[model samples]
Target chain A: MSKAEKTLLNVPKIQADFPILHRKIRGKRLVYLDSAATSQKPRQVIDATTDFYMRYNANVHRAIYELGEEATREYEGAREKVAAFIHARSPNQVIFTKSTTEALNLVAYGYGLKGPIQAGDEIVGTVMEHHSNHVPWHFVRDHKGAVLKYVDIDDEGNLRMEQYDELITKRTKIVTVSMCSNVLGTINPIKEIAKRAHEAGAVCVVDAAQAAPHLPIDVQSLGADFLAFSGHKMLGPTGIGVLYGETEALEATEPLLGGGEMIREVHLGRASWNDIPYRFEGGTPNIAGAIGLGVAVDYLTDLKMEAVRAHEMEVTRYALDEIHRIPGVRTYGPEDVKQKAGVLAFTIDGVHPHDIASILDVEGICVRSGHHCAQPLMERYDLPATARASFYVYNDSDDVDVLMAGIRKVQEVFA
Target chain B: MADLRELYQETILDHSKKPRNFHEIAEADASAVGHNPLCGDRVTVYVRLRDDTIADIAFVGQGCAISKASASLMTDAVKGKSRVQAHQLFQLFHRMVTGKPGDPVNTAGLGKLAVLSGVSEFPVRVKCASLAWHTLEAALESKKEIVSLE
Candidate 1:
């Protein structure tokens, strides 16, 4: 079989791996299209976590016993897996945190607030950022007296590259952007943006919370100084995330939290810090979550990131084609599949998004309806809220048909 | 497990379609804006009080069907009631929507507001049904801050 055909055929097999897909919702078959919020875990990911607790449950990096050594090996092995997944220079470049929000805050506080940003320096960001990426810079601006500049997007939800170019001047200290919009699903040109930031003598921070699940990332080629993403959004467990920083950037950053593991030597009121990644992980980390995330990375690796991207592209293309057939429906983001990802944020005239979500819920179709944590982007488009359907590997044409039918039901009820 | 019919009743659909008293009151005595940061639903409640009695009430804003219909029905039900009675009604309505499963729904004196009893099943939407009532209470007290159910 052709590579494309094999990937398409794997959709059903992927669906079967997620045990939650077998359950019924409201007496009907479940049609989960909210992968952007969080992906359902497969049995392999679940069992890996369960096995960690049942067999080798011990604090890592401290004990010298057998179980403790095993736990430390698995935990560090997960960090290596994450480093390889993003093609980081080394495993020491990966730092584990609680969530994507925490990972971004680590960079914003550790790097931005420490010494890099001075008073009157400029921090350039885009309007398409999720709160995780947007609000942290606001803190830098508020506390450090740094200026914040936002690059606007076109009507099609594509960031204006010319405005971004103009925004990055010699005085710009940092340039932060999302690799893909959580709401619009517009894939940005991060390599070009990172290169421009570097040319202007500014550090580049990439928020890959949305991109890491759907796209193949090569940090070396992307030229980002730092990147962050959550494990839960990528079919791994919650409460664990990764921050990938270049060696120079990580060395310059100060630890946000001061605790046991982050210190090399301690005295009364003063201490020297540990190495790069260990210094960032202050406390005992989410050991089981990291192990499970390693299993998830292996799962995605076996499936091939290219196959995952192609499957989502096909599903999103099919959705875009059929969505135009429905009257009074307005969709956000770039219409071209090449420029967009799998998220579809839309509004039906004369019907509010909350009501639409409730209606879809009755049909056992799970969709996210709100600002999607992108209130700035919502305000840019003058929208109160929108109902969004995001796709993933387990979703296929059958799920899209169910969503289309459910939307018709919403219209008929409102009519 | 509640059916959609129980929540989006015909009266609710009608009121949501053609909401009554859905306009700003000119030179109103009291007004307050209520915001639900979750869904960006906002409603501004205006009240004209005459000696502690609600002489006129109106609201203007955008929200889901439940909120708009609830605001519309609230204006009609509390127009002639005193401030004390309105507060009592608000308390009763809040309980009706936020009641735990197996808790008896006390719809006494709730009248048309009883239709929102189905909101108890949808815990996430209770704020949508109660946003206007919270705004109305703020307006009655002449509070200056915007009411928020974040």
Candidate 2:
């Protein structure tokens, strides 16, 4: 075993922190391997959310009551936690949205559609982007007449650097790419890509929905003008996400929504927007979800993000080795473990992905099957769908054993 | 694993591997495409209706065993039946797979399709078993568009 393999986290202790892991599925122990879709929440995060609703349930940023003050403090405190988690320059840079989809749309519409993007200008993205990052750019292309370009990925699922370099030019107004692909598990060099985009005088947007959970992200070092990630994928509650933008980028982009919380002063005809983050968060926000996410951030911090990444690397390596031993199994993504996260996308020759998923479910294993919301990427690979098994902090080698056993059973059934 | 056997019966597996009437009618008078966006399952149903009587039916697509086998059995079942009879069979098959409460399984007319009665045990897969039937409905209605099961 490698040194990295020896440093794997204490899986039994971490798995115990998640209450859902204790439950049985179909009279069998549940082996969850679908963290990319959404993570199982830890007890600490769940208790924090319940604590908020039970103890201090009040509207924020409006009322002057003591309960209101406490609510606002917790909400704002969560924002600070997110900022520190991502190494954002300031808490104000972290704008809370509903999910990564809404965060990316905010950037696409607030910045790309409103004005900055002109007709015939190019907006570049990778072919491997989830629909959230890809479709919004299509909207910009169709409505604004901005030409959209895609950087292609090789058969190994690595981004072709030459194509990426060729796609970004002086006419490129914005370049949005995922820091880590949800399907292929390929981790791109965000700092290098951001530098290239900056040299071309274009803003770089990082879709960190899959990256934020497994990787340590520093917005300053990454050189990203804007970054978006979801809460549910990182062991937090749903309906809460973060969008980190440089102060100047936030000031330049218009607010996507107009409501009570996002406005400073309103007149009959015109209304001035609030400050950077406040201007973007409209209406009564997801207060409980934010507090829960804050607790999740604290939990991850306690584990140390570096340790989390190392653990995932070890588990992914073990999974890759075990899966390779299975006949007729073909895996996608970077060959090197360092170039990927915890996702393992594969196909069994005779059995369809859905069938594999179904058989796996019978064994109390959860895996995602289908296009993974990246139809364009699926088209590029000429594959209808794939079965994906993703790992998280709580996963270990034992979970991989169950997954392998399930795959072998599927092959036997089909054979 | 026993429940899984019921879902993927030997007949279903055989048909999925080599589905009967699985081809594109180059001169199909009526054809419609059905797509399940969630699983990327797509099936295009083609039919030749002569004097309101089904003369021929065929399908071509890629999907799971359940869906492909379902399509194969559907084409075999509805190839010679009239338009009205095909519609009745579609309704019966839908109810059988969906397991609508109070609606008992009526396999009196359904032949090979009775094997798929176990589909109700897996609720999420009901759509997979019904994709081809839905496309056949669209083709019969003369709808000139893709049918999306969102």
Candidate 3:
């Protein structure tokens, strides 16, 4: 193991941050390996939600009362923390939507023009994006009559940037990809690709949903015109997320959802829209969710993103080394552990993925089974689905041990 | 007490290791494909018939324990039975998998298959346990190339 692998944190304090870890399930400890779906919130974020509800629960913006003013300031302060975390220039560029799904859809619907996306104008994307990225892009393509293209992935799950170079040209309007593949956990080279897209005058959108929790993200450094990520995936509350769009990109788009707050003036004949961030944000925001997300951000900052990534690296390197030892077991993605994130997908020789998942479940080990929302990628590999175990900061070597013992049990059971 | 998990008793494991009638019958009367997308298990079943009676059946594919065991058990269960009798057995086998106890698919006698009844406890594995029967039923209903329960 290298220095990055040895950089694991003194993470004993992490259990205290998440209260639910104290709870028992089926008379045993809960070994949550599904952090890729949603993270368990820290106590601070949970308490923050309770505090907001109990003390100063009021709508943000255009409030005169004391509670409302306090609520507004706190909410805006949360936005600043988010902006700073991602290294954005200002909070004005950050748009708070329900999730990465809604954020990507807002861009697909709002910024897309009919004429620019003529009969054959190309929109280049990759095969590894989550359904949150795939479906919305399809919605735009169908409506605008644009051609959608996919950049091939190598057998190792790395993007074929050379194929991307051939596919992208003056006709390419948008290039969207996942920063970290959810199923394969391959951390993509977004900065280099974003530069490539910019050279061709195409907007770049990065789905940073899986990256935000494990890896430190800097939107400006990545040079993406728009990026989307969900809070729930980052140890925050569900139904809240951050969408970072370049100020110029936001200014060029129309309002996504029409309602009370996202407007300047309305008439019997026509209605004008609000500015960038507010324009995209519709009425009655997820106030409590946002506040909880702010608390989650604080919790992660306190833990240190570098430490989190280090611990994950230690666990992943250990897992990758051990999982292949089983007879007939197969793993997918970049062979270099450093090139991967916390997710590891594999198949056992005699056992199917669902059978593998079921056998693991008996030992109180949780894992995901199936195509993992990348059916096209599955088709590329000629596979139906795979069993995946993903890690986060909360996971430890013990989790990996439980997983190892569980796989051994499967061998014993089938023996 | 029969350990249903031991339905794959030492005997079942032996059968799975060297599956009997695990081939394609060139002069088969009907054939079908079955797939389980969740686990990537796919198999083809071919049935050879003489007149209206069941003659020979074979299967080929890659699968897990439940599917391979079920296929091996199926080849053992259906040889020498007539088409109508095979449908009756297929119906009972279907009910056992789908958890519909009183479906018309049940026949009076399926002794060793009762071990498979324990499989109904695991809903997801039911398809894995019944892939061959579903393909047999599909072959009886339509083209025998591949029938999907996916």
Residue-wise lDDT of candidate 3 within A1-415, one digit each (tens)?
A: 3223354575557876788877664445777788998888888888898999999999998789999998888888889888887889989998999999988888887776522356667788999888888888787778788889999899999999899879998898888999999988999999998998899988898999999988988898899999999999898999998899998887767677888889899999888888768888889888888888888888788878887887787889888877766676788887676789999888776656776776676566788888888888888888877889998887877788788887887666667
User: RMSD per prediction, one decimal?
Assistant: 1.9, 1.9, 4.4
Instruction: Let me know the TM-score candidate 2 reaches against the reference structure.
Output: 0.97
Misplaced by over 4 Å in model 1 are A1-9, B101-104
Residues A71-107 of candidate 2 have per-residue lDDT tens digits of: 9999999999999999998999999999999999999
Better of 1 and 2 by TM-score: 1
Q: Model 3: residues >4 Å from true position, as ranges? A: A1-7, A23-28, A50-75, A113-116, A324-327, B1-36, B43-63, B71-110, B117-150
Local lDDT at A53 for model 3: 94
Winner by DockQ between candidate 3 and candidate 2: 2
Q: lDDT score, residue A363, model 1?
A: 89
- CAPRI band for model 1: high
TM-score of each: 0.97, 0.97, 0.84
Best by TM-score: 1
Best-matching candidate per DockQ: 1
Residue pairs clashing in model 3 are B31-B144, B32-B144, B33-B146, B33-B147, B91-B105, B92-B105, B92-B106
The sequence of per-residue lDDT tens digits that candidate 3 reaches over residues B25-96 is: 887778888887666778888888888767888999877767777888888788888878888887778776
